[model samples]
Target: MSIDLSIDLPGLHLKNPIMPASGCFGFGREYSAFYHLDQLGAIMMKAATGTERFGNPTPRVAETASGMLNAIGLQNPGVDKIIAEEVPFLAKYDTCIIANIAGSTIEEYETVAAAFNQTSDVHALELNISCPNVKEGGIQFGTDPDMAAEVTARVKAASNHPVYVKLSPNVSDIVAMAKAVEKAGADGLTMINTLTGMQIHLPSRKPLLANRTGGLSGAAIKPVAIRMIYEVSQHVSIPIIGMGGICNAEDVLEFLLAGASAVAVGTANFQNPFVCPEIIEALPNVLAQYGFSSVQDAIGKGVSVYE
Candidate 1:
């Protein structure tokens, strides 16, 4: 049977549910050589700030058991550069474009969103409110319901495209944060950003990363991501773009069943630049095994039964 994998968010329509996490996928140029960039649902560009960022100091990344820690600190070429250079490059492809914007303050967030507001190339905005690696604006806005809502409202007001609030997994209550953003008029939600973690070096007798702590990702956090997506989906009405440790087609299906309208691949990109296409190619057979004819039919299947 032919399987239809199309998924629709507020103002966005994806041919499939697989896309790269913001920082992992670099403006669609590097990965375009591996496969047709338009084959995937969308391209979530690197997080852009109001101004260019040098990012964190050296040794900002460390490897752990089944995952990796990164303190890259939202390093980007800034919003203007993205609009002038990156967006046009990506617009050459057939895939939708989702800009992930970050800032050190509320006004910065507004500025970045407003800049994108004038662009027709961008299909949506994924607010990076949950970046733990950043010191100023990321996790701070995501961890607090009030601040999360405030940022959502501000960005929503400034954005002409749909705004998706990416929530932090470090919070005490993921559902509460999801609800807050929804109430603040978020068009969609991206659940469970990387968890905060630290690694120690045996010889140096110090932290492995220069920043001391970093956001942990990969297979290590898949279970947490699933749980948070399940919980948040139950509490909120907006569409969810679930991401965390998604490496294969099975993992993507699991996220969809857990109530995610879409899923994103992160560290997997570093290991296999072809992973996204691999997963997309395998999706049809997997859906057949589960007796699913279309991707939309499986979304929130588990949640509906549990509730």
Candidate 2:
């Protein structure tokens, strides 16, 4: 049997189940020079807010074992800039463009999501509430079930595009959070955003990131990501976009196997600009080797309970 990689989200569909995570690929223009723009599944643009942010100061990135700490603070050119410059450039590419939306308040998220809906160039909205570096209610909304659900409900009310809540891994019970968003009419979920972690300079005895704590993302986060995907997938029936520390195609299979409807590539973009293309090309082989015809067959393939 031949497995088909084509999958559909609430308001958007893709040719494959592999997508580039937001904040990794810069508006799809940078990657266009590296490889064919249409090779991947979809493009999740960097997180954008209602207004432009200058981002945090330097020393925003701290390297850790198998992971990295980042305090980027969602420093995008704002939604208007995206509509004028970024979206037009990305529209030229023949792939789904998921606008990753972030804001400090509920109104902020709604404003950005509504703007993305109006752009028409955007295919979906990926809400990134998991950023610990921000103050206006990012981690607050992400970690609390009520807040997460409230944000989802408000954004859904204002958004025309499909909304996928990109969850934070820095919570106590991830399933609760997932269920909250699911109940709030969330179209889909994206599990396991960067975990909250920090690094410090021994000599100075101070945190490396200007924000003191940064979200940790990279190869080391795969296990946490997979576990969260499994938990969220088992709890909710909505489609999920799983992402954490994916570095290769094999990692792609792991997320799908853990029950992710689709998987995202993040920190790997910085490690190797070719990571997305390589995973796109390698997915077929990985499926075939795993006795699967397509990535769809891999979803929820190995979920089991310890009871």
Candidate 3:
């Protein structure tokens, strides 16, 4: 029995609900060696900036108990390179391409969004307002509702395709942020970017990561991601792409049940290059086990059942 795993996001018709999180999957070229790129739902390319970025210094990544911290600083070759080189490379595949854009200012975000507006290769745009590793932009626009709405509105107005605002978990009221972006006219949402954390090298008496504080991701944050998705889903009407420590079919199911229209696999992609396809392959059986006939049938299943 073929369980229909396809999901219809705001402007994306995903073949399946499994794909790599931005920054985890490096533009989809490297992972092509592991599996066919078209086997998954969509590819969220690395965060693009108005100008090229060298990213953070050495020691940008460190391991923790159940996760890892990263301060990669949204390193990329800029929007021009992404559109000229990477977009065409990904267009070769039969997969949907979602470009993740980061900026230090609203103008930068608008510039990148408007640039993508001229392209037909990109199916959607994910506004990276939740990246904790960056200094100027990223979480700065995400923490406050007004700033988050401003960035969302700007990018939404500039982009022709759908705009999904990636939200930060570092905020005190995540639902408020979600509602703010929704009011700002975000087409969809990707909840719970990495939580802010730090690690110290006890022996050297210095910070483990060069940036001192970095975003934390892995199994440790799955609960937080689910809770935020659940909470935000209760308030917003737009579709959600829930992510944060999703490594297996069960985790994906949890996200769907919590009201995510789709989900992105992040840290797991780093551990196993074949993880996305593996999850996509395993989803049918998992859905059948829960008595669901289609992936969409499971979305928000537990939202009303619980609490």
Score each candidate by Cα lDDT: 0.92, 0.87, 0.92
- In model 3, the runs with Cα more than 4 Å from the true position are none
Residue 281 C-alpha lDDT in model 3: 86
Tens digit of per-residue lDDT, candidate 2, span 1-307:
5568888777777888777888888788888889987877889999898899988887899999998999888899999899789998888877888999999999999898888766887888998878888877789999899989999999999989888999998888999999999999989998788888888899999998888988899999999999889888888989999999999888888888888988889999899999988888788888898888877777888785332
TM-score of 3: 0.99
Scored by lDDT, model 2 comes in at: 0.87
lDDT of 3 by residue, 92-140 (tens): 9998999999999999999999999878989999999989887788889
Candidate 2, residue 186: CA error in Å? Answer: 0.4
Candidate 1 colliding pairs, count? 0
Predicted candidate 2, C-alpha RMSD: 1.4
Question: How does candidate 2 fare on TM-score?
Answer: 0.96
